[model samples]
Target: MTLALFDLDNTLLAGDSDHSWGEFLIHKGIVDAKAYGKANDAFFEDYKNGTLDIVAYQEFALTALIPLDSAQRKQLHNEFMAQVITPMMQPKAVKLIEKHRQQGDTLVIITATNSFVTGPIATALGIDTLLATEPEIIDSMFTGKIVGIPCFQEGKIVKLNEWLSTTGHSLDGAWFYSDSANDLPLLERVANPVAVDPDERLLKHATEQQWPVISLRD
Candidate 1:
C-alpha cells in the first residue's frame, strides 16, 4: 500500500498545535504569560523563516510537562482539545483524510511537535500512526528532554527512514502534504508532494516546481 503522510500543524489543523499548547499553558497560568508567549511567537516566526533551532524549541516546549504528572498533563490536554483544538479541526481536512483512508493508504501524521502535544490530536483525526519528536520519559514522568533527533526538516527524513526500515514500508508512490517551506526536504523526497495552503516560500517553490497546490481551509 502507498504511504500517505501529513504534516500536522497548518496543513491538517487550522492552527499550530505547538504554539496553541504554549498559549494554553499561559492561559491556565502554568507559565509566565509575557515571557512564554513572547518566546512562543518568536519560535513560530523562526519556524516560518526556516531558521528554527529545533533542539532549543523542543526544550522550551517540553519543559512545561516536566512539572506535571502524566495524569495532570492528560487532563490539561483534554481541556486543550475541547477549548482550543476542536474549533481548529477543518471539515475539508477530515474529508481528505477519509478519502485516503477509503483508498487503503497507510496514513501517518509526521510533525516536529512533541508526541505529548500531538498524539491525541492524531487519534482525534482517526490516524493510527504518528511520527513526532519524542519527549524522554522515566518512571511515567516527562524528563523535559528529547530521546532522539528532533523531527524537523532533514530530521524528518531520518526518522521516516528509521520507521520504514522496521515496518517494511517504502516511499514508493508516497504522498506528502504540507504547508511550510521547512518541509520542502521531505516534500521533495515524496513521489507526490502537495502544498496545502502553502506559505509564501513554499508557494513560490511549488509553483516553480509545478507541484500541486491545494487548500484545506477553503
Candidate 2:
C-alpha cells in the first residue's frame, strides 16, 4: 500500500496547534511559570517561517522549563491531550484523513510537534503511525529536555527512513500533504507531493518543481 504523510499544525489544524497547546499549559500552570508563553517564541517563530533550528528547540525546551522536573513536563504533555487539542482539529482535515483511510493508504502524521501533545490527535484521526519530536523523559516524567532529535525539515526524512526500515515500507510513489515551507523537505522527498494552501515560499518552490498544489482554503 502507498503511504500518505500528513503534517499537523497549520497543515491540518489551521494554526500552530502545539504552541497553542503550550499556551494552554501556561494558563493551566502545567509548565514552568517562568518559561510560559513566548519564553521560546524565537523558536516557534522560526518554525512557523520554516527556518527553525532543531538544536535551538532542544536547548530552549530544556532551559525554558527548568522549574518542571521530568515528571512535571511529562504530566503537562500528558494532560495536554485533553486540555489543548481536540477542539482545534478542523473538520476538513479530519475528513481528508478519513478519505485517505478509506483508500487503504497507510497514513502517518509526520510532524515536528511533540509526540505527547500530538499522540492523541493522531489517534483521534486514526492515523496508522506518528513520527514527531521526542521530549526528554526520566521515570516517566518530562525532563524539560530534548534527549533526541526534533522532527523538522530534513529531520522528517531521517525519521521516515528509520521508520520505513522498521515497517518494510519505502517512499515509492507515496504522497505528502502539508501547508508550510518547513515541510518542503518532506514534500520533496515524497513521490507525489501536494501542497495544500501552501505558504508563499512553498508555493513558489512547488511551482518551480511542478509539484501539484491543492487549496482547501480560498
Per-candidate TM-score against the hidden true structure = 0.99, 0.85
Could you give candidate 1's per-residue lDDT for residues 1-218 as a string of tens digits?
99999999999999999999999999999999999999999999999999999999999998888889978998999999999999999999999999999999999999999999999999999999999999999999888899999889999999999999999999999999999999999999999999999999999999999999999995
TM-score result, candidate 2: 0.85
Residue pairs clashing, model 1: none
Per-residue lDDT of candidate 2, residues 73-152 (tens digit): 56766666566565566777878888888998899999887776677678877885999988776765556677566788
Q: Please give the distance, in angstroms, between residue 60's alpha carbon in candidate 2 and its true position after superposition.
A: 3.2
**Residue ranges of candidate 2 with Cα displaced over 4 Å:** 30-35, 62-84, 216-218
Clash pairs for candidate 2: 70-141, 70-142, 70-143, 71-141, 74-142
Instruction: Provide the lowest-lDDT 10-residue window in model 1.
Output: 62-71
Candidate topping TM-score: 1
